[model samples]
Target: MTLQFSATALFAHHGGFGINVNPFETNLINLIIVIGVLVWFLRGFLGGMLERRRQAILADLSDAEDRLTRATAELTRAQGDLAAAQQKAETIRRDGVARAAAVREESEKRTIEEMARLKEDAVADLNAEAARVSDLLRREAARQAIEKALASLPKKLDAAAQSRLIDQSIRNLGNA
Candidate 1:
């Protein structure tokens, strides 16, 4: 209440709040006094507060920088690992392709060799069968010739010749 009364009295004494006595000088002097008192009382407190806030901001910045570095290192390592995996995959794929080609070539070679062997076997079997057939044909021809000779031998001889031969055989038998 006294503060309010004193403020009212001061304002009343200053020409009743009007443009009479050039209030700029009085108001400026009052503002300067108030600001001076506030500075005098609160300077160390404000300075300490500003210093603590600055340290906190610096610490946050340092922490952010460290996190960024760590994140960058992790990204680099991940990229390296990805590249290594890709290289390994490529190597494996190449090896698989080479092995498949080798296997196919080997299989083809084996198939050809097997075909050749089968052809040789077939030819040998054909030769053996031909030889057996030839031998059988020769035996059949010899048998037929012998039968014909036997069938024609009596027809080829005459009756006179047979009588003479019989007389000679009887004489030779009497001598024996």
Candidate 2:
């Protein structure tokens, strides 16, 4: 075959390259029809998938909210329990302090009472000792007086006087 180099055959039309306004000649109408068919066919499938995904997200959000509510309630209950425990501990502390003070006061009172009793006993012992010593001194003085009188009696009395005194003592003994 022979190659024919004709400029009229190389370019079928005499117009140069430019934007084509005719949709059929440029195949733009076929592209629109193909896109419209694909959108219509896949609309239900894609819509169903998106609806299911949205429902799943809503359910997850609801579950998270419920968990948050439960956690908050539990925290509140724990705080209440902690407050009650603290109050109970404070009450116990106050009671312990009061009891300790009462015990201390009672101990002091006992100590004071014991001291008073010991003081009374000491005073009684002192009075008894003084009385005993006074009695002893009186007895000693009486004995000495009798001895002195007896010692002087021998010098002062003669035999006749001694006989008269003896006779008077016998008469006195007889009367008793």
Candidate 3:
């Protein structure tokens, strides 16, 4: 009346776990038929889809190429514009330098001329001052000489000399 367990019975096969060599029992022929039918039916659809995808990829590549070409052209144009601007700036800089040099030269010339004119004017003023001083000295000398002569004349003359000088002056006047 005891129950016994066997490890072999638990793992025993009822002919359901082995490889089958018969194609019909394994349904291998049906699987092949179904695969062949699906391939035949979906071939056109799959090919059309692949072709459309390829065309889209080519169009995208063409668009990218066009953009690259346009970008290159724009870059070239910008570089040319930059070169022209730089050339113009250089020209302006040269012109400014030349103009500055000319102005400096003109300023120097004017300064030299003005200095010469001032020097001439100073010389003329000095000459005028010298002439004025010389003329004043001559007038002073003459005045002093006249004062000395009048002062000595009163001392040298007496009453008899003054009477004879007066008699002689009257005779000269009568003759004239």
Candidate 4:
């Protein structure tokens, strides 16, 4: 068999398969051999197409492997980020707790101070009231004593008589 692409007009209108079947067309062995060659050629063409499909499938697999690697790395990064976020949240929670406790303690301290201030004010008011009452009582007692002394003054006596009365009262008190 000789290679002859030029002799075979690719698109002849007659579509004769480019074969001269005048004599060999009637020979049984020659016909069988021609059929075998056609089958062999068809198989070669189909096999090449199958090989290209297999190569394309292998390329798709390689691309899928690369995508899987990138996806795994992204998942690892996402997990790390999640852990960091959790730690940050915990820190915030602790800070919030501390701030709340501080606020409560400050509020308690302020409440205690206000209570102490109110108590002091009440005690001061009570002391002032007691002082005013004692002063009023003292004034009343002094007025009564002055009135009694004034009323007895006229009946007491002159200065020399009062002096002698005072000395006699002292001697009588010493003897008792």
What's each prediction's TM-score? 0.66, 0.69, 0.62, 0.64
lDDT tens per residue, model 2, 133-157: 9888876875676567557766899
* Residue pairs with backbone overlap in model 4: none
Global fold similarity of model 3 (TM-score):
0.62
lDDT of 1 by residue, 1-176 (tens): 22123445666777566433334534655677899999987888898999999999999999999999999999999999999999999999999999999999999999999999999999999999999998888767756765575466558767786567557656854774
Q: Count the backbone clashes (under 3 Å) in each candidate.
A: 0, 0, 0, 0
**Clashing residue pairs found in predicted model 3:** none
Please tell me which predicted candidate would have the highest TM-score against the true structure. Answer: 2
Name the candidate, 2 or 4, with the larger TM-score value: 2
Ranking by lDDT: 2, 3, 4, 1
Those runs of model 1 whose alpha carbons end farther than 4 Å from true positions after fitting are 1-30, 149-176
Predicted candidate 3 versus true structure: per-residue lDDT over 49-111, tens digit per residue: 999999999999999999999999999999999999999999999999999999999999999
Cα lDDT, all candidates: 0.79, 0.81, 0.80, 0.80
Quickly count the clashes in candidate 4: 0
Best by lDDT: 2
